[model samples]
Target chain A: MEPELATPFRERAGRALDDRFLQEALTVATTKFITLRREAFAELPEGDALRDQARAIKEATLQRLDYWLERLIERIESRGGHVHYATSADEARRVVLDIARRTGARMAVKSKSMATEEIHLNDALQAAGVTPVETDLGEYIIQLAHERPSHIIAPAIHKTKGQVAELFARELGRETEPDPEVLTRIARAELRQKFLDADLGISGANFAVAETGTVVLVTNEGNGRMVTSLPRVHVAVMGVEKVIPSMTDLAVFLAILAKSATGQKLSVYTSLVNGPRRGGEPEGPEELHLVLLDNGRVRQIAGPLREALNCLRCGACLNVCPVYRQIGGHAYGYTYPGPIGILLTAMLNGPAAVKDLAHASSLCGACMDACPVRIDIPKMLIELRREVDQQGIAPWPERAVFGAFAWLLQRPRLYRLSARLGRLLQRPFVRGGRIRWLPGLFGEWTRTRDLPAVARRTFHERWAALEREARR
Target chain B: MTTKAEFFDRIRAEMARTPGRAPSALAARPVRPREGLDVLRRELSERWRENLDRFQHELERVGGVLHRVAEAGEVPDVVAQIAAERGMHRVVTWPRDTLGVDVAAPLVTRGFDAAVMPGTEVAAAERARLRGLAAAADLGVTGAEVAIAETGTLVVVSGAGRPRSTSLLPACHVAVFERDVLVESLVQMGLVLEAWHEGAEPSWRGAAINFITGPSRTADIELTLTRGVHGPKEVHAVFVERGLSVARRA
Candidate 1:
């Protein structure tokens, strides 16, 4: 784990809240995304049914994952492409490194891929004496700043343009105005040379067609096209669940993916690459490799979080999530962020990894509504909470308090007695008729939020008094 | 480090351990994709004018330029006008046989440094030099294999004479297509994709199929939209009303 994660999620979230620029950026970015997504979906009359169809397709694919994967491997190999299976993140890293070593790759141009981030591939590449350059504008900015992406679609959403201008001056040694146009042009000129010089290109597959052995990459900036087309060798890192049944299924996904992510009818470039360069083709990579990454995804096929495999990584849920809107992606302390990110973190790590994270959601169900595939994130989060509790991963104080509350609930006489006692016991802590602060471990809850004071008169007592008055 | 056998074994075991959440089925694939596509094309032929109008509307909405021409020979005039407006001269294009028009010769005649890609594989050094030429060129011209109206996307396939960079590396991209290539929605494009892959792939076909919706764009900096980041800054679609005399590749 990185050192930042060691500070604990609370401190990280506090830090994010204190940063005025980040707060403003998060609000502006998320609100704009929400509006755009709503407008995009509102225009499509069939959007609702398409969401269901997309979900059904994902479920159907997972049901026969082995068949599809085997067929995909056969198709790619027949077209002279290599498919490697990795059971873990470490294994996936080694597989990529081995390929790089054999191909004599000194530098790799990368398109924005969450899969590569999930496996932490860049550091490994750097350690092996191979430079990995991020080509996506947002990703490139974050890479130079030595920061993880704050938002999935807009990785540099947390950075202000002024900050970016400063970053460029400091890192690239090129000073320019804080204009997006100028900054983008500068990046284009710098990365264009890398694309031409790099021997290897790496990308993530948005969807891989088992029918045609095609790896699909969607990007608004067209970096996906450059990384796949310009290099001598192209390697695509993909989660095992990314494969769809055929080209027909691909259309269903493409219809909603961009609208859900960035509100574009379609991203500027959607590259459907089938293996490598064919015999008579004038341009394309001579060698193509597809890394089928398991990395904790395979276990979820039949496990509790199986529905999460349906995620398209569109980042819609992130924009709509209340917790995410406030604290942003970094506070999540993981590769993914927002509502879906929590589930993904738990999926990649174990249930223990999300002990506090599981309680992060407000159970508003906005994420499910925003989700293109409707993965039921909140339901799975509740399940994870149960798992955490059962495994004794949650703090003992929390477990004991909840246990005592449950016991008291079953006994009405004791419950009523405790309520009367609690009202009197809470007098000192109660301010403005709310529990603003509490002492000891109980202060943890009150520090960030307030709790309503126990009603002065119990509901049962009020009911009895009302009945007596009615009889009189 | 896990072998393919071990991977399959693990997946198969997981599958046997539990049934899926619910009974589900995949979206129905076209049974006879080639026949379906032909039927779609015939149906579209009568209503192509409406489709083209929609394509123009959507294309412009997404920051692309649409030019309508009476014949294939008129394409170069549009290309020249665009170049003149932008003050751009150097042009790289797909070969005449592949692009279905002779734009290079006319472009050169009009004082543009136009270079047409070779129709067959070239040696490594020559290929590298051609790539450099593409990288430095101001304009790229290619033929659209499928023009989707719903999203204003021009699908271009890279093959023997058609390199992917022709549509990618240049600052501006212009694609020529006929009414027959226009489809109303992504669903129809899916059928076309299935049809293209239904039979054995053509010998000339490369490994890539690109859906170019508009000029490249990004909103990474403070969510400010910027165009032509890495790909073309301008994307122009030239529609030839009278079909090209040369046949399109399968």
Candidate 2:
């Protein structure tokens, strides 16, 4: 759950690859998501233009974020909802804890919120004496197992039903069968009580509409509705970049969000909460708080990774990514994990944090195509790689190798001499037109992949010989 | 903690650094959403039947059941039949004034324990009791504010007699609506939302407006689709062809 940070990224990815069950699960889930999204987009004639409009809206909002956020605060306050600004993850945790402390909250039920996971809110809530309950089925499973979500949308995809059955039997003392239907029924009965009893409901906003002072939550399991409606107090934590202009803008986003996520036209429930309970409402939360989080997003407004701010967190990018398909989300070792995750990790934690992750993608550009907002993830990743190199965060061996290659490329004579020398040095290693392995530190590269053998005659030498023959 | 002023100041500082990143603009909003909605609704009225057909097609495609009736009086019978099929005895619903039909009396006559939500705010103890009833009930019937035909969505706004849990807490949820509530697409739904927030909000309107596309579902367990994880498993929409007497929003 703490990101398994002790292990290196390559080792983590190796572990995932060796796991037969995880391999099967990842392949099945991601492939299904890919097919569903393709079918969804294929049906909608206006999807491409909507994607462009959504991206433009995100960029335009960032340009005037201060104005829009000010308007949002005014509208929310007018409707009796409170807004809190947190500059860092620690401050965000404190803000939520203070609200919980002041409101006399004991039990808190949560919908699936990646922002909360990023801030590590569950530990804080527990340390402060309030019991935090994850109500989403996938989230609840992982929470009980003391694990983090493997996928954004499907958190428990890595666990087979038998594993979940064992988890539930151990955690809840309910001896349930391994059938998904039975396991789901048990979860429904178990979480229904928590939804009713919990005094606090915390969620992550998919998008916050500034003009209407509305917090829109799109969910398929309907937990978002329950969390916002049942609890006496509701708190929504969101990144500062999620604030959109108006309901019209929200429509454009909604059109593609679920389609990109799971290929549903709309997630089962999209709850737009203006504030808390109104005067004559029969049932609703009495108080609402929106915590605007700026973990590391403000700097990216002018930074190289700014395009990543446009990400919708749809996980469509994850499904289509070849690297993610092989390694899975847990291997990335962060709150977000995929092609976009590399950029987002850099955005939240700095480029130095993702020295290896920046190179995780093959730069095939499938993620950009799958993104609802069309965030050029590969472009940002390339920039992140450059930033890492510029910051001297790359390993010394990698830097030295690239530096030597660049130096050689600059001098044609030196490059030719090196190629000729390589022909003599590589005689021991070259076999059947491939270098199976190399000696010393370079052997690490050949361990997982083969290197092409240096030619007997270089391309420049061949071209020079051809020129001489033509002249004759 | 960052104050609002400081947060904005940081953002403004970043904006100053990037002057010509790109010349971009936000989506153009409806200049006069109220007028725009009026004209759009008038145009859509002529094709209301087509929209209804589309709505039903989409709704059924998403695993929601659609029931058509000749009049408002026929809704109770459909509700009763659905309850019988499920062997559900207890029912909760919006009050007659909000639902535009007297389901409680008829459901009771048909030997079901029916409880209608109160129109006015009640004491905390009574609120808890009603919530318990809703949680314990097998069926929940409510009125939809708008139904989008394009996505098979029933939009319900929580208000005076309309509790959010009526459509959420029960295993089986039945929503009754008329032709007036049907819209063609999400864009039209957006216009309706704009118009609702254009002026002072209606005093009775609550905090949440939910768009229910289908029954609550999840594919978290090895990508196996499961329904009613935390909400209703079955969602049925009863359309009254003769329309109800309730005032429709223009």
- Candidate 2 local lDDT, A98-179, one digit each (tens): 9999999999999999999999999999999999999899999999999988888888889999999999999999998899
Best by lDDT: 1
Worst 10 residues of 1 chain A by lDDT: A1-10
Put down candidate 2 lDDT per residue, B1-250, tens digits, no spaces: 7888898899899988865666467777888888998888788888889999999999998889999999999989999999999999999999888888889999999999999999888888898999999999999999998999999999998888888899999999999998878899997898889888998877778889999998999988888899988989999999999846553332
* Model 1 agreement with the true structure over B1-250: per-residue lDDT tens digits: 7999999999988887765466567989989999999999999999999999999999999999999999888999999999989999999998888888989999999899999999898988988999999999999999999899999999999988999999999999999998988999998988999999997988889999999998999999999999999999999999998856544465
State the displacement of the C-alpha of residue A199, model 2, in Å, after optimal TM-score superposition: 0.6
Candidate 2 — which residues are off by over 4 angstroms? A1-3, A462-472, B247-250
lDDT per model vs. reference = 0.93, 0.91
The fraction of reference interface contacts (C-alpha pairs within 8 A across chains A and B) present in each candidate is: 0.86, 0.87
List where candidate 1 sits over 4 angstroms from the true fold: A428-433, A457-472
**TM-scores, each model vs. reference:** 0.98, 0.98
Interface RMSD of 1: 0.8
